[model samples]
Target: MNEILEQALLYDFYGELLTSHQKEIYEQFILEDLSLGEIAGDAGISRQGVHDLIKRCNRTLQGYEDKLHLVEKFLAIKGKLHDINRILDEYEAAGDNAGKLVADIRKISDEIIEEL
Candidate 1:
């Protein structure tokens, strides 16, 4: 996955675990795509303070991911859904009996849903 996209996903899954101040700084840096100096100016902090806060936020988010693995499971389920879609498309193109394929897809979908 792309680095920024991965960061966004991680933040999406775990950002609420951070304090309000941390969330604000993290959103400025990652979601808003602000430079350190810009964030510092807006937050009334030094550039180095902004940098350290971002680093701390990254570590805190990673810790949540490490404990819960929610992001990993989400990505896996997404890949499985994509694969199922591709299989359905192939079956439609071939005009074949896709009953067995449908059953397998349903099983996989159920497993993913149960994981959540």
Candidate 2:
């Protein structure tokens, strides 16, 4: 997957850990796909200030992930799903066991997502 997509997912997964103001600015910059200049214009800060804000926000998000391990857990679950998919798809010529494995994986993934 793309690094940008991963970063975006990590941000979302850890965003609630940040202050509300940070959330608004970050969402505007990342999820909204707005440019730094655009965000700065709305936030009444300089463009460089907006850039620094985003950089600091990214660091804060990473800090939360490092401490809470929430992002790590989510990423691990996603990796497990990918592995399960590859296993099922590659053994398409196998018996019903693959179908059962896929079903089990889905069940486990659903439970994990619920906990998240």
Give me the candidate number with maximum TM-score: 1
How does residue 45 of candidate 2 score in lDDT?
92
- Candidate 1 per-residue C-alpha lDDT over 54-81 given as tens digits, one digit per residue, 9 for 90 to 100: 8898888888889999999888877877
Best by the lDDT measure: 1
Assess every candidate by TM-score: 0.82, 0.73
Task: For candidate 1, list the clashing residue pairs, or say none.
Answer: none
Quote the positional error of residue 69 for candidate 2 in Å. Answer: 2.2
Clash pairs detected, candidate 2: none
Tell me the spans in candidate 1 whose CA falls farther than 4 Å from its real position: 97-116
